[model samples]
Target: MASSRIRTFPQRISGAMAASLGLLALLVTVRCNEQVPVIMWTSEGISLPRQAPPTAGHIVGHQQLASYLEKALDVGPRNVVLFLQDKMSIEDFTLYGGAFGNKQDGVFPNLEGALRSSSSPLVLPAVSWPASNAVIGQLQDQLDTSPLYMDPDTLSQLRLNASSPALLVFRLPYGTGSDLLSAKETLSGNDEVIGQVISIMRSQAVPYTAVYTGLQPSRKEAAALSVEGGLGGGRSLLQSRGGYKDRWRNRERQQWAKEKREVYAPVEFKEDDRTCMLLWAKGLTVGILRNNRWEEHDLTPATFGEGVSPRLHGSDCDKSKARLVLNYENVLGHRSFKLVFVMSQRHYKVSARRWFTLDAVELEYDGTKATFNGSRSIYAPAEYSYRCHSVTSFRWPLLVPRSAKDPANQWRVSFDDFQIQGFNLSGNEFSYASDCAGFFSPGIWMGLLTSLLMVLVLTYGLHMIMQLLTMDRFDDPKGPGISVPQTE
Candidate 1:
């Protein structure tokens, strides 16, 4: 019996050890599931939004949205939407009015038509989103004591997940309406913020197509670690410069053209006036006026949104790929003017900052005055203007794509600031501008720094240890040898 027991013990121990090893190997493999990189676009240079934006009904506000996104959209700690929490006050309408206060209270704006098919708003049907208690609990602190205008981030985040994030949208530089450019121009420093958002998205290889609106605060201090380098001037209708909108479509591969409501672009010149600014075609640039001042006025009637330009035929013009010549002869002594053409949409999509190179830029105005010569993509090189001084950027224009086969009106195109550079002259993608991603992204730079730091530290530590040991060993005659028998 004793001999049998010893034999069984060895067999049992061997089986258990094999199982343990198998489990350990599995856990390691599972943990090694590498995360696919993601792109992030924070409105106004702020990646984490602190305040709740008035979006898709604050039925649930920011607090709820953040929690919902953290669980559903983010893959791990490294991939979640990070909200910058803040406190603010809204009107406590419940105190001022009772149950019958607002006529719209009982009638949900979006669900009014389906009321008969469902229960009353007072006791809504069981929802896929969190219970009202869960959402309100998360927001209780950030929001004021107002009952009607309660914060609802948690609820929103839940709802966002239930629906298709691919279709979720953003407003232009201003409020969500037609006047995208004027709304954007009202607030300055837009260029700087845009540059930052672009770089981060590009480097992480974020898959969603994006949109942005509102003024960029130019007063923001330079940040050693800021994605876009720093803020602009800190000007705007909002109270502070940062923590505005920390939003992103939380889906894998958010295709643009399929989801974009508005258009955005980064430019170097505000108004490039060189030619008569007539018939224009596609290629991604607007025409320059003769006066050297951009004349990208509202081609769209006041009734239309600023982002929407009048049809090409509406302006009584045909599709033509015109050029702007920066000749000193055209540089009128008295008339300091330029023209910006709002080309049709056969080619230019008025999309977000991706990547492109300024192959050749020459100043041609019927004379040998200047030449736009360069091999690099940065349009604003130090010697940029010196070589083409006379071409002082009527503040560049953009070419709205033109479809040769479409009716003239169908091909009509117009853009505002934030639009295809109705004013901004630079032809760089916002994603890579100023440490932001224009033609480039911020993730690329950050990844590079991270790798370099790791290499340097590891290499230096080994060198120091070798030096310490060698210093003492120099006194030994046989060079610190330890003997051991050879094994066949």
Candidate 2:
């Protein structure tokens, strides 16, 4: 019995050891297969979009609609019928009509019938145009007899001074089955009538809105339509220099002012102007414009830390122009990024300091780009009313991994085409760091701890095995021992 128990002890110990090793292997496998979540940061805060679709039956007021029309169709007429037709199916068209309050007034049986009996104020005149000048003269005589047909100039002035007109709503028949090409052909055939109607509207200075219910258009088709309708030429009414001024004032009122401000002087770079070098490195192309000329340079690992100083003349000198410096500091497990922008100018007899703010910053990594709108300002203190310089520093968290083994984590910094709002930089340089930390990340520390625990467990198991193998069996002679009983 003692011999059997002694042999079974080693087997039980081996089984337990194998079970522990298996559990550790499973844990390691699970950890290795886990996916890491990515986190992004901006000045506003962490951004996460609400996951709900917009509610149905939302009513957009008249003022909101006017704003939309001004932005989408330009500041011309408040009322205009924009027919967006393409190869999309009718089913796709039904999905887009909620914005204008899709209330049905009447439904025409077919497209031809719809055009003939269309309630649209713009189309009605075109439908009723006289075919001959004699007919037009007859209508004019009838109009002259009525007191309503007073002076034409007065009528035009009244139309111009009138408030915005009501929205004209129309819906296509549910089963038109008409393709985009066919619909376009039908409208093109009526071009003469359409042109006459447009001429009359422009002459009268009246704004009218019309909505054409048809198939939805793709992005390319929409862009083409916008160009054809002259909707792409005008500047947006909502955006202006005054908007920025208001933003600055609001920031001041909210007590969000920064410690310093960078006051940048005006600098213009024309396409044909050649003054600075154009640097191309790692799929990034930067055009350095200086002194009315452009110079070209290539950025690489070898030239990363080196600074390029361009020669300036007259007003283009460093004292009058903004200077931007880009630096990369390699630290343990990651890389730190910093952007330093300096603005300097000569001030005379001014005791007060000037303040300027950076409105936005845009960064592009490889092919992906992100824009951040955070205000960082600097104050330009006068040096005895002679010279003043203000510096603004922007620091970004570590981005690149420190481990060379992680080639996937390596990223090349590019700022040649980087956009810094509210200032046009005159010069820039890339600086690199010489020293970096090794195995400094939290993940590395956790891995080391796990490995140390595993080693201790393995050592304990081996020590137990050694102790069992060298144990004195004869010490327990009364219970279980190796004895030659027959010989005795």
Model 1 Cα shift for residue 152 (angstroms): 35
Q: Which portions of model 1 miss their true places by more than 4 Å?
A: 1-71, 75-369, 373-447, 464-488
Highest TM-score scorer: 1
Candidate 1 lDDT, 39-148, residue by residue in tens:
12322222332222222112222354445434333322122122111110011111111122343332122112221222211111111122222333333322212111
Tens-digit per-residue lDDT, 37-153, candidate 2:
100111111122312211221222223333333332232333433322222221122223111224231111122222333322111001100111122122223222211211222
Angstrom error of the Cα, residue 156, model 2: value is 58
Q: Show the lowest summed lDDT stretch of 10 residues, model 2.
A: 121-130
Model 1 residue 456 CA deviation in Å: 2.6
How far residue 454's Cα lies from its native spot in candidate 2, in Å, is 3.9
